[model samples]
Target: MLRLLINIFFLSLVQGSVAGSEPYFSLADYDAASDREYIGAVGILSRPDLGLVITITVQSGGALLLGDPPVDKIPSTAVKRAVCGQVISFPNLPERNLVCR
Candidate 1:
């Protein structure tokens, strides 16, 4: 039992170190907007070397306008990146421009 416990502790230490060594990327901000007629989402992506990236997407509910509006849109869902070293904002969209730092 003692030997097993020591091995388990060492394994846990190694795993913790490995996990901490890698850089982590996370979504800084996420929001959704709707006027009861249209829906949109915005997200901010952040990383160590990569600057902030703002992403915006809109989905129309067709003519029927069925289903509830989405509330969980995240930055990772964005497939396009704004221009480097600049902030771009849309006049009509609710999300502000993504500013690269």
Candidate 2:
């Protein structure tokens, strides 16, 4: 009985941890000039000891034009702020390519 209870408790903790680490899909607009689209996975991990950690993994990205390459300015702060599933745009670039959702 004690072993079963301990196993159940561990199972619950594992389930909660897995649930907390699930990644969510978000739109990634690497290029606003083209009709292409992209997708990214955003995941947030939190622990009482570790505070919070945000992770943005690009699942798929759009293609760049022949003469146009990606800009060096990536709005990481804006992306972190907009992680709650909101559209974010980067207006500093001339072509305005870095947009995240």
What local lDDT score does residue 96 receive in model 1, on the 0 to 100 scale?
33
lDDT of each model, Cα atoms only? 0.28, 0.29
**lDDT (Cα, tens digit) per residue for candidate 2, span 42-79:** 22222224232223233344321110111112233432
Model 1 C-alpha RMSD to native = 17.0
Clashing pairs in 2: none
Off by over 4 Å in 1: 1-50, 60-89, 93-101
lDDT of 1 by residue, 1-101 (tens): 54345334323322122222221222123232323222333333233244332233333321111012212212121222322222334345443333221
Supply the global lDDT for candidate 2. Answer: 0.29
TM-score of each model, in listed order: 0.19, 0.21
lDDT of 1 at 27: 17
Write down the RMSD of candidate 2 (Cα, Å).
15.4
